[model samples]
Target: MDIMDIARRKERPAHRVFSAGFYGGSWDHDVRSVLGKAPRGGADVGEVLSTIAAVEPHDTEAWPTAWIALGDRVGAVAARAAERGHRVSAARAHLRAANYLAVAVNALAGRTDAEDRLQAVFRRHRAEWDGFTAQSGWDVRVLDLPYGDGTMPGLLFRPDAAGSPRPTLVMVNGSDGSISGLWCEGAEGALERGYNVLLFDGPGQQSMLLDQGVVFRPDWEAVLTPVVDVLLGRDDTDPAAVVAYGISQGGYWLPRALAFEHRFAAAAVDGGVVDVSRSWWAHIPDSLRKAYDKGEKEKFDRDMALGFKLPGGKAAERTWAFRARPYGTRGYAETLDAVSAYSLTDALCARIETPLFVAAPHNEEFFPGQSQELAAAVPGAEPVEFTAAEGADRHCQPLARELTEQRVFDWMDERLGR
Candidate 1:
């Protein structure tokens, strides 16, 4: 390619909040995600900015430590508020504390003591989340939805205790999102629109993975079917208006599930994903990919082990380990093969009869163009574009939650005749 060719292909930053690096760009997005929750009481802008100011750039340890400190302080304030009979203040503070601690949980990914720290911080975060749910002044039901001889943890939030049937919204989380994140993503907005909201931890999600040792599975229909069954059994749910929405990795799971489980009235994905493995394969070297493709698992594993020991490879190795854990595989080749099975085939897309909404955001960092591919493959599916001009570019529109939610729910309302 010539210089002019390269220049023509170059693009500008979507939203330049920070420079490029793990602690810079990635952390900036994470901070924006938390701040986006401020409108829904899941976060406090001042508290979030103050927490960011205390962290040192590129210091992995400092990232989690600072967030944890903020969470602890906020949690204490929440406890004091509750003691003083300020339920609304306590609920808001607890929600923010839960979100702050969730940030810490994500930062522990590449740490030496990640497993231990993850367990401790996750439990604390869940506690704060529970505290918020109890005091949020909503009619919330803590549920144990049946799934394959076990139960999936879930929360069903209703705007009131009128016991009348209402339109319902099932919110699915991404690979590593916290329960509080569901509120920021859709639950709070759904509630405001008078829709009953259901949030749960499927296999490989928060409670399922951390507490029950359940890992991710390619056939997500098995996971979502049980959720639909539970929703249908509730008298408070409008069977004709039960819809689903998913974000991030859920962009793949929900579509895959809709192919078989056709109970949903409508569905939406914040950035569609045609193949979950594409993101994983993007980081693997071509030589390693060749070995894996050739079924040389032993050779690939040996080469990967050596590569991890090279200078500057430790961080990458740690990131791989973190991402691979949900696949329930320790071997690099095995994890890659497992993730490869998550692709959506043309046949699968053709089987989906539900009305679907796909968010094709510009500058999608992970699954670029996959949203368009998914829309083309799925007959009658609507693909909406969220561009950089509206500050709603990038994977999932982390900083543009309100705009994303508005478009998605509006489409859903039109489809469900709400």
Candidate 2:
């Protein structure tokens, strides 16, 4: 068994002022992107904290407003820097401003409609991020990948290093994250190590869900196949050494993709998720489950209706609704049905032949012990458990991202013969 089994996660209030776990984690976690004075002189530590201090936690109505306020302040700094011909300074400020606004948009929870002001903030986030990459000497490309009928937005980061063909890491986003979120998570580190990085929103992910209404499906191969086609066909990619790295829910997504798309040289998941249904089930009350199991769809829906309506006000409603999109179900029964199908049967797990790395952190509240289950199911898949003692214990180790990145990429490097 993985060491994660011995390190049980701590319990916290369901609708508290501050949250730290993944399922309902706090918005403050985004500050990890700019922690320790990020943007190198562009982001003021005191100012960032001041922005955070302005709002009350679990206030969804006020969430986006506070974030936009902070974003605008930082954006002004970016504008001034650009005007003064301070390219590097402007780039850093723009990057920080973009991150701030991205979190702002994310904080708007259930308002996933493109016509909403939330989308406008996200558009600004992308624009500012583009400004940052252009000035940072990073050769980043914004392209559209051919998916089903239309296209999926993608960001490909080619290292400035000169090499005929370079190893590339294709980063996959999790349940509630975006490509922009991937940049601060692990993409920057991958680029610095002379590895090309690619980030894209698959079905039911980010803009795909919001703008296109593409719900997520269990058959991940359909999405990954085209992504592989785009990456390998590029002249700069080393076809033999492409690695698939999935984050958050992508832990389930990355391995699932590799199970069918064997062309990838290696694959890694920050937190391996063996069964989404199991995770969701563990969080629900037994009474609700019994009703749902009995196929009492209407009763189950009525009983679970008030669950999202917590005393925390609008924040509670938005938070639950935010999580509802993944299943794309109308009611509680359909949600269970949808999530029940989001699992890799033993047969599928046994078929995964690519080298695999599973990072299971202690105190992982979201999907504890699933990593060990994944490793045990797959042939030769390695599950590396990180302990709270090492300061790498939360979901995806967001606060300790550097440690997770080093371990994951190093394993990938060795697997790809880098």
Candidate 3:
């Protein structure tokens, strides 16, 4: 089934925690993300609310500054707690600080000094994340999984340090998701359920994009195959029970990879995505789309350039830059053209033999109804729906991590017979 065949939702009023127009829907969703983590000590409700209150909606500078300040403050608290030998308290605080710092890093996008600020804030986020994992007392092992010409950085977390084979869940992050965000998404829950969790920064993700300048590739099988190789080499990973779980944009990458690499016992995407370019296309005008279709790259670029000079065009241009940077493309037409390659065909979907689960959530802001389309195209794929009634809708059920984890991990457990 083609993604276009699925019906798209009309604009309708939905519940929101905040409605700051300048910051956009992504800002509100990011806020809910931290708050949702409070249950698992990834954040504090009071701290997140207080930080949000300090920022002025219209002041773009205020956004990153406030978050950086909050991150600094919490980071210091974590340091102090660690000094006092309060390991658990220190670990939780470190996670919160890391998450806040990541928020700041994200807010730096589109700024004149975005690259500098991103590098600075992202380093702090990475430090705090490292501190949390080291102090949390979990059985965590740092890994260097081999990739094309380099190695992808990863962390493997087990229930204990005792070397014993166990069911493992490999967690793949979405575009622009921080390592700390992965903890709230599924890593923490997986550990609690006696599942070994592996988290990594693949191409165009965090360290790879920022530090190594590695861009995203559509053939994600090239990424996951190496990950599987590393997992199978570990004495602590169960060869028969290794599974996969991905969220957000990973919804596309995981399925794309599984179509070629079939070693996973089971796999679940918080939502399924068939055509990743649809999200990019939604923002583009039909005129430009037509130009691109006709291979008129120069005309497409010229029209886009003119569009950015109109009222509110600067902001649009900034957004385009932020989204396009990871694609390793500078030209407007080139980036869209690159992203359009990230779609799955019926033949590719048919190649997937692994047990697949797809989440179809209400009000999926990006790639609406793509999950249904993906499930329909893949034979024997299971599709699960999350509704606002369950407080588990939107892109990744950001505000309902517990519910999302429960349903997803439960399916995984059943599939792995654990």
Cα lDDT tens digits for candidate 1, 1-418: 3464345334324344422321334676788788888888888889888777777555677888999999999999999999999999999999999999998987785565678988899999999999999899999988898878899998899999997999999888888888898888889898988899999999898889889999999888998998999889989999999999989889999999999999999999887999999998887799998998899999999999999999868767767877787788878888888889999999999999999999998988889999999999998999999988897888888778899889988888899887
- The lDDT values for all models are 0.87, 0.75, 0.87
Off by over 4 Å in 2: 1-25, 28-45, 111-115, 161-163, 309-316
Q: On a 0 to 100 scale, what is the lDDT of residue 353 in model 3?
A: 94
Model 1 pairs in collision? none
Worst 10 residues of 1 by lDDT: 16-25
- Residue-level lDDT of model 3, residues 1-418, one tens digit each, is 2232122111212333322111344676778777878878888989888887776444567878889999999999999999999999899999999999988887786565677878888899999999999899999888999999889999999999887999999998998789898998889899999999999999999899989999999899999999999899988989999999988899999999999999999999989999999998898899889999999999999999999999878767877787787889988888987998999999999999999999999988898999999999998999999988888887888778889888899999999888
Candidate 3 Cα errors over 4 Å, as ranges:
1-23
Q: Lowest lDDT 10-mer window, candidate 2? A: 1-10
